[model samples]
Target chain A: MRVLIMAKEGEKSEAATPPTPEAMAEYQKFNEELVKAGVVLEAGRLYPSSQSKRVQFNGKKRTVIDGPFTETKELVAGYWLWQVRSIDEALEWLKRAPYDGGTFEVREVIEFEGM
Target chain B: MHRAIEAIWRIESARLIAGLARVVGDIGTAEELAQDALVAALEQWPTEGVPERAGAWLMGTAKHRAFDLIRRRKTLDHKHEEIGRSVERAQESVDLDAAIDEEVGDDLLGLIFMACHPVLSKDARVALTLRVLGGLTTEEIARAFLVPVSTISQRIVRAKRTLAEAHVRFEVPGGAERIARLSSVLEVIYLIFNEGYSATAGHDWIRPALCEEALRLGRILAELAPAEPEIHGVVALMEIQASRLVARVGPSGEPVLLLDQDRARWDRLLIRRGLKALERAERLGGALGPYALQAAIAACHARATTASETDWPRIVALYDAVAQLAPSPIVELNRAVAVGMAFGPAAGLELVDALVAEPSLKSYHLLPAVRGDLLRKLGRSEEAGDEFERAASLTENVRERELLERRAAECAAQGTAG
Candidate 1:
């Protein structure tokens, strides 16, 4: 089965500031482990909200918000498409990730049975 | 839908064969019945809307054929009459409902033992193992191993015929015999993995499907025999070695020496899995087997963040243990490499020098390659260049030869400058 493991960005976990080398190494090491296990099909870090735009729809009235949005409570910071035996296994991997703090969501990808 | 059917067949075919072989008392007939079920599925499934339980559907179809065989027992020849009698006996002992729900691990293990029975040649054992246990078609097996499809088909046919002729029982051996048979299975699996691992010099070396297949087999065996330390040991060893595949070759398809490989590029997940398997083997509590010992040595390299940080002495000690377990010229050569790193180039050169007179290693490229490295370290550039040239001449791999020749040229340039 496949699960998309996305962890929310913490208050201090914003990527606006460059990551320390140690942190980067730690993250890379963790990512490498997942990749080596053949578990990770895809993984990536998202660009910060600073370089993002938001469009709101109210009966087809488009309200655009540009630049950094202040509400950074539980926005997803990164995601990985991981192959795991179960949701518990994916959760276990998520718990061991390099994130200091974040709620991780494991979304099961729907597929035909036996695929 | 077609992909789903392939996936189901891949997962279910082995169990189907194993269960049928146990009931049918022979693998050849078991395979034929299974094939008939598969053929039936192909014809009916697309129109019938694939069954809810595809594997069960296949097994039920096969069992129905087995009953047909039972009814026609009176018309069979002498050998088949015996098989029919055995089937009748098996059916009497096995309740239909429980038989379908039976724990299949034992049957699968039996199938593994039968496939790797020492009566067959190593190539035949390998081909049959892949075909039966891996649920791979003959064409797929041939392509993976780079052999002709006809050859693989012939090997399978010959192997099954031999097993039938020899009256080989479709059951796992007991006690010490089981241990011995298990080793044969491990050796064949490891051989398949190595074939994939060594295909680095080829242009199409990106994903060695054989290695993946071998690993899948190894992982399944480990699960099926969790208490067997050697099983975990071999699994660990393969995982660790496989972890390095991404960094083991250069962009131009040249081999990368272990120390030169990018550590970050090594798969940490595999390393962790290997380490876990090693711990499991050790926890099983016995003197480490040859595979486990080798995994320990690989772990030493894996644990180190860099080449200089590697515990060379620990690796040397592990190699010493491996040499004790499986004393071969190859083990000695690898031990020399570890010894060199632990002591010094001079110390390593001494071990290499000893192996130089050994007949088995006379034409082995790595022996001279190790000798050349030691000589280079000792500042004997002129002699080192000659050794490298000899090593290059002995090697059949084009990329490796080029690398060795380039090393020889560097040594020549150094010799002239000095």
Candidate 2:
């Protein structure tokens, strides 16, 4: 199974301040777990909601609006996709993920037909 | 007069609604059709007398209503040619018995997962599950959750629109996808059972109708996926816990504590059924899942003749297994209670105090309630009174609050006695 890990809004602030040497080392240590487990098929942190966009479609017309989105829950600050066996196994691995205040929404990717 | 109609509807409405959903391919429309049939039955049953098979009559009437709906919609000549053809085909081949079995048994677990799909928020999932899968009226659900009927109605409407707009498939997922969907399915079942057991904000302590509905769904899931031990485990857990419903309340409707309940009043049939399901779960050959372990714990209580005779050590062990499977602060709190009962209050207090700084326990009422019990047992009556008072205020149930307050008074009386 491929699952996504996302960060809630206001979660990127910890990354904004220049990390102390020790903080930088801690961050490296965190990423090392993801790498060592071979679960980090792909991962990245977004630029933050201030640089986001809201896309809406009314009938056939598509409108894009600038963000600094008011609805913090609508934004994803970071994401990851991991290949795992089952939801239980994925949850077991998720317990080891380094999360602070914000919640990580985990979801399974819908496999396309004939893929 | 309406009560009889309601009793029949609660049992039969899910199948009617599911079958209608299949035909109409729109849950909102399906519900409207089912309600139409319900109204017809209400008006006719008194005059005509209730049919020999009330459920079959309801299903037959609802299917005819679905046929009527499709006919009316087809008259408008919709542009979705493929959809029209499928709806027409469904209408054409409408044998009541085949259709009933087809619709009623069409992957209920899938329907549950679809209802609790990740796109919807938790509140939305709960409202939709109650309305669609549980066959509960919006007003009934509103009363159960202590929310306005309009709020529940809006949640259901929005949930259906969101699923339709998202183009969520009605079919069950396969392989890893199925496993990923388990948590949502389990959460829905748990919510269903919890509402039935404690009825969060209602005059009743136990809503037997809702318990029966959840158990029926759980049993269906167990049969559908025999290889899924956890599904059987959940079914067993619900069955065993619900078996005590007969003994859970007094004739005058006050709540009955577990130890005070008469063991003879417990439903032996349900206990037997639960034990059988648990055995099937164990036969799957993995370390018992959280639900199965909890079922084992409940089975221990069911097997014991009296509270004094309970295998507290086995229950503590089962809780330990549950903690390993789903390590939550709540589970730890429960394990501490079992440990306290098995060993002594002091041992349990050690575990409970260790969790004082655990943030998740901050708002949980059980932490204070359990702490108070331990304190009372340890003869620290003054401290116990304070804890019980705090717990009483935190709990929302009127009956539970009253019981806690009474316990607090007892603690105070014990202090004076000493």
Number of the predicted model whose lDDT against the real structure is largest? 1
- In Å, residue B235's CA in model 1 sits off its true spot by 0.2
> What TM-score goes with each of the models?
0.79, 0.64
**lDDT digits (tens) for residues B1-418 of candidate 1:** 5655665676578889998888776678889999999889888888897786677789888888887786667466556667667667667744565656455778888898999999989998998998888777898788877779999999999999998898889887889998889999999999989888888744443227677678778877887778899999998999899889878877766788999999998878779989999999999998999899988989988999999999999999988888887899999999898888999999999988999999999899998899999999999999999999999999998989999999999999999999
- Give me the runs in candidate 2 sitting further than 4 Å from their true place: A1-115, B1-13, B32-104, B107-110, B200-208, B224-226, B250-256, B379-382, B396-402, B405-418
- Reference-based lDDT, residue B129, model 2: 84
- Measured by TM-score, the strongest candidate is 1
Q: DockQ scores for all the models shown?
A: 0.05, 0.01
TM-score of chain B of 1: 0.96
What is the lDDT of every predicted structure here? 0.82, 0.75
True contacts kept of 2: 0.00
